[model samples]
Target: MTIHTETIVDNGVNTEALIGARGAFTEMPEAAAFTFRSTCDWVSGTESSNAINGYFGLGQEHEREETFTIASDHPAVFAARDTAPTPPEIVLSALASCLTGGVAAVAQHRGIQLRKVQAIVEGDIDVRGILGMDPDIRNGFNSVRVRFEIDADATEEDIRALVAQSQKRSAVFDLLTNPTNVHVDLA
Candidate 1:
């Protein structure tokens, strides 16, 4: 089988390359089957940091590693030392990064030169649920709001359409907006 690949460069983004890879995936769905793995190990006190390391491309042709640290703590009022950002903050960061990436990709694909793209993702959580004060409340964010500030050579309507396209295609957005099954077992 012959595969065709082309490169479309727009402000440092290779739109054709991304499109080519997607085409390849569509041609061979099995090639797109991939499992991302991560492990978090508790390091110190209950309120201390946890070392997180992860890798991608377990069943694919390429692989990469990412490592980071996260902390869990409560405010002084809760009698715990506050260190790094909490887990929810990390979730927001992930969402922001994913959305920003989508914007960049979409702009490149549409041949729009972007000067800047910023995404602000915010989640509102009611602490009563986490504190076990209200069983009816949820233990997660009640709502999430995402706002984008884009500077590009395109009309506002075009930019809005691009953002919509990005949101429609973003994996992270889908993951958060939809239901996913997760299984946990002792390793």
Candidate 2:
């Protein structure tokens, strides 16, 4: 199939330039080698809250330092006050944002103009697993669902295709679908 390329400028994204960059990366794989790092420190005397800080650039360009706080608590069961969203909720937010970004990029690349796009992400989890009440159950979300409400001029079929393509290209989706090695140690 012949890919018709069009220049799309919306929301600070240049689709034509993005497609060109992607083609360049396909030719030079080393150009795509990027590492992302972040550090999270525990806040307060308890372990209910954490302060996360990280830079938001690819490769050697560290860019700017971004910081945010996350917390979790139970009303009376855990003896802590609920302040911010739990870490799992933060993961859901990340997934939603990543998927939304992918959708926007794909739409732009396809020459489709979008009026608005919204995503709702939900994950099902059983507290018993984390509480050790059910040893057979996993300690994380059993399943996740993402629903998108997109307003665009494209046909429904084309919109569905856009979503599918976005899922295929989303980095966060790949990270959640694939296994990643993580190591931890006392400092």
Candidate 3:
């Protein structure tokens, strides 16, 4: 198939650029290594704000067009104002976002024209774990579930494969499914 570098737009994604990136990564796999950074500051009682703007990827430093900030707060039941979703809620949303983007990108790459795509993500967590009420319970989600509703010019089997492929490629899914090493220290 003929590809136009500047004109192949699918699902609002630059397919040509994506293809170029795939080729580049295939040639120099190290370019795929990326480090993401975020800074969070305490705002008030159980409230914090996070800033995301810079990262290193494709063997170069990259900055976003604008800094994105998200504020988080605990619910009133937790003795804090319910002004914003808690950090756990943010995690759930981020997982949903990653999977949904992957689905769209995979669809575009496979030449599927999508009419609509929606995902509902839910995480089950026992607050007693975070509350220190149960030592046996983990302080994280026990499980996460995602449901996708996709309308596309593909069969149901194809749609299922698309979502499955998305999950297989999603970094967030891997992170959540596997154990990751984390270190916290006084700086």
Candidate 4:
């Protein structure tokens, strides 16, 4: 006989535990607020590396399982070494990751099992703005698109609704769609 813990995992999410957490957060809404941070350092030739390991959540500090590092660099056309993915690519990745996680969580909560999830994310950018060739142009992607191919134990309408709900709850999606105040000064 196989033994199983009390955890009820569906689509890789602990549905039972999450339900309990939802109740806790509902009672103490302040605990639901979380702050995430990442530190980045410039390497050379438009190359930079970032590290993330700690965050504050549930009214307390928490550390990640391990330090995660990411590297970004510009292409050679911009006199860069093209060492790693570009920063914009990383943003797309973050969006995809957040959406995918939301999908899994939502599926688990709805008792839907996911078999496969694939996504293709793309962004359209014009370098003229960043290069200062046109002041009127924006220095970011003009548009971003994400297409998902998900195989789950649910109807097509349900899957579509799952993806839609994921987008509605995705932090990264909101960050990209809305404006955020950013301050950078000499430290």
Top candidate by TM-score: 3
| Per-residue C-alpha lDDT of model 3 across residues 48-146, encoded as one tens digit per residue | 999999999989999999999999999999899878999999999989999999999988888888889999999999999999998999999998999
Clash number for candidate 1:
0
Worst 10 residues of 2 by lDDT: 55-64
Q: Could you tell me every candidate's TM-score relative to the true structure?
A: 0.82, 0.81, 0.91, 0.91
Instruction: Please write out the lDDT profile of model 4 over residues 51-164, one tens digit for every residue.
Output: 999999999999989999999999887888999999999999999999999899999888788999988899999999988999999999999999999998889999999999
Candidate 3 error regions (>4 Å): 1-9
How many steric overlaps does candidate 4 have?
Answer: 0
Weakest ten-residue segment in model 4 by summed lDDT:
5-14
For residues 1-187, could you state the per-residue lDDT of candidate 2 as single tens digits? 9999865536445777887878988888676676656556566433465555544332344544656656754443556455556677878888998989888888877778888899999999898898899899998899999999999868999999989998998888887888878789998
| lDDT of the candidates, in the order given | 0.78, 0.77, 0.91, 0.92
Q: Compute the lDDT of residue 178 as modeled in candidate 1.
A: 92
- Winner on lDDT between 2 and 3 is 3
Ranked by lDDT from best down, the candidates are: 4, 3, 1, 2
Q: Which stretches of candidate 4 lie over 4 Å from their true place?
A: 1-9
- Per-residue error for 182 in candidate 1, Å, reads 1.5
